[model samples]
Every structure is written in C-alpha cells, then in structure tokens.
Target: MPDPAYRPAAPGDGRRCPRCGHRVSRYNDARHCSPCAQALRREADSCPRVHESTWAEPEVQSAIAARDFGALCRLVRGHAQLRQEDLAELSGLSQAFLSMLEQGNRRLTNIDKIIDLVNGLGVPAQLAARMFGRPG
Candidate 1:
C-alpha cells in the first residue's frame, strides 16, 4: 500500500513494529516506521490478494492478479456449480491442467474452452474474456 498516489515508499514514511520488523504497507504508505521498514525491505516480497469482487484490473494487474487463480477456480466450481471432474469431462483438459491454470502455472488457451466454462457459470462470454485476457 503506497500513498493515495501509489508512491514507491520511503524510509521515513514508515514505522517499526517491536514484535516484528515488517513494514505494514497500509494507511497510505506511512503505515510503518523505520526499523520495520528495514525488516520489510529485507523480507517483503509477498503480499495478499483482494477477493471482494469477481475481478479487478483485467489488463494491467492480471499477471499479479493471477495470484487469485484458486479463488477463480473455486468460483467457477462453486458458483457455476460445476464439479472439477465435470469441468474436466467437458473441457477435455485434465483436472490437474485445470488446477494448474487455476493456479496460474499455465494460462487458458483455446478461447472456446473459456467460453464453455463461462457458459456453465452463466456469465457473459465477453466479460469472462476480459478477465481471461481473450477479449476481442
């Protein structure tokens, strides 16, 4: 969490946590203080994902957003009411392949496969395409 403007963050902009040296990138980048900043800088390569909505920033943030592959897979199975096995049956792509695609290790190809899954979910193909980066 950078500033309201998404600044790259600076040392003085943070504070240190006595319990942990990690810098909390929240509350407009000024969230953490010094010592924490150092610790965070040292071990701060990971972050959490946002899951409140279907998807956000379909284009610019997707590779990173791809982190939500599991959730998307869940939504496809749960909301669309398609079982992993059933999806496997229909897509001609293995459950493990689907899992990998859902995990972001692989990507979706053959736009029609996406169309099939989206169809099962009852979501419009165009919107699904945007989320999957196959939008025309």
Candidate 2:
C-alpha cells in the first residue's frame, strides 16, 4: 500500500539525468542533473591540447597566417570536437560571442582576449608567438 503522503514524480515534474540517473528538476532544462552538469562543465573548462600535426594543416596555417580569429575559432572548435558552450567556457568567452565571432559578425581584436582564447585552447607558445610575430 502506498502512503497517502507519498507522491511519485510526474513526467512533467522532473526527469532522471541521462548520465547519472539522478533526479533533475523541470526548472533546470539542461540534459543532466545539477551535479552532473557541473562536472561536465568543469571537464569542458579544462584546456585542450592541440596536436603538433594540427599546426601543419592547411586550413589552420591559412587562418593563422591571415590572422582570422573567426576562422581560427571554427577550426579549433572542430579539431577539439567541442560545442560552442564548452569552448566559450574554456576560453572565458560567451557562447553568443563565440557564435558571432565564428560567423564573422564579430571580431576579436583585444590582445588580452586573444591571449585568453589561445591559452585556453592550449596553443603552443611557439605557434602563438609565430602567429603574433612575437618572441617565443
């Protein structure tokens, strides 16, 4: 017999997180529970190491040579297999800003922001130096 005070969570009330099967509130529309989502966000925030061979890629070289941050952002996102939200979190940029930058609606011209982006993406110092025409 079910207790009168016991009420099972209704479908619209909440759902179990797919990752950890933890109860997630309906108010939180994210795919995971708060804890799981936080963990995932933390993981995505870590700097991603770019492979040495990636620097040799024609697209990467061209973007770097042209100093097109929009193109570079797209390339890095693809190479790292990261979503805009993840990349934004890693690079200390907003997802909307990254989207605008990638679409050419915005340009990243601030040196400090550029440094944050490059460092967050784990670009090698030598490559970054070459890109910026600065001593490594």
Candidate 3:
C-alpha cells in the first residue's frame, strides 16, 4: 500500500490547472496558471475604486508638504492598502517605473505621468494641487 504521506509524483502533477484544465510546462504554486491569474487580476483591478480616507496623518502630511516624492508614494500606497503592482495597474505605469520612483532612482518631473498617477490613485484634488501645483 502507498504510504499516506509518501504519495508518488504523477507524470503531470503540479503542471496542470484543475480549474481550467490547462497543461503547463512548469510547476506553479497556485492551481491556476500565470495567464489565468493575470486575467483574474485584470478583472479585479478594472473596478473603479478609490481610497475613502484623506491623507491626514501627521507623518503623511509632512511628507506631502516636504514634496518628498518617494516618501509620498510609499505613504499613499501604504495608506491605501495598495501594492506597487496594483498601483502600476491603476496608474497606467509600469511596475519598473513605479519602483524607480519609489527608490529615488528616477526623478518625478513629468507632469503628465504625475497626473496619471494622481488620477489613478484617486488622490484628493486639493492634495494633488498642493503636490503638483495643478489639480489633475
């Protein structure tokens, strides 16, 4: 008898998604494949949503007032419960670009991209005006 904890590896174990019944070449941690998971993420992220609270914390307000772009990005994302990937999806920016901004590797000077970020993240109009000198 096969030992309960010593199940043998099947020929295609961990390489097929049970939900979609699609065979993949590599093993994935989730039952769904990469494309399936990304599709689901897109569907979920497509919903029009915004953070309901204002950036009122003293530290966050200080960061905004200082115009510390990296700190502001971190504060906004953390307060809104958004991951960098989610922010990228919402802001029409690449994860790499956002990471660069957060890491201070890239300067945040482009008004157009900043507007996109402000709109996508649903930043308060007054706060956006203060930060960017324009209400986006």
Which structure among the candidates has the greatest lDDT? 2
Candidate 1, residues 39-98, lDDT tens digits: the string is: 677665432222323433343234323434345665555544566766676555678878
* Cα-lDDT of candidate 3: 0.70
Q: How accurate is candidate 1 locally (lDDT)?
A: 0.53
Model 3: per-residue Cα lDDT at residue 128: 63
Preferred candidate (lDDT higher): 1 or 3: 3
lDDT score of residue 125 within candidate 2: 78
Ranking by TM-score: 2, 3, 1
Q: What is the lDDT of residue 105 in candidate 3?
A: 94
**Cα RMSDs of all predictions?**
14.6, 11.0, 11.7
Give lDDT for model 2: 0.78
Clashing pairs in 1: 14-32, 14-33, 15-32, 15-33, 16-33
The residue-by-residue lDDT of candidate 2 on 1-136, one tens digit each, is 3324334566776677778997877566566778997889788767455566676677977787677889988997788677888788778989999999999999999999999988877777767777798322
Best model per TM-score: 2
**Which run of 10 residues does model 2 get worst, by summed lDDT?**
1-10
User: Tens digits of per-residue lDDT for model 3 on 1-136?
Assistant: 3223333336756466545778644544454667886787798877645466647766666666666767777777887777888878788888888888889898777878878877887767767667755322
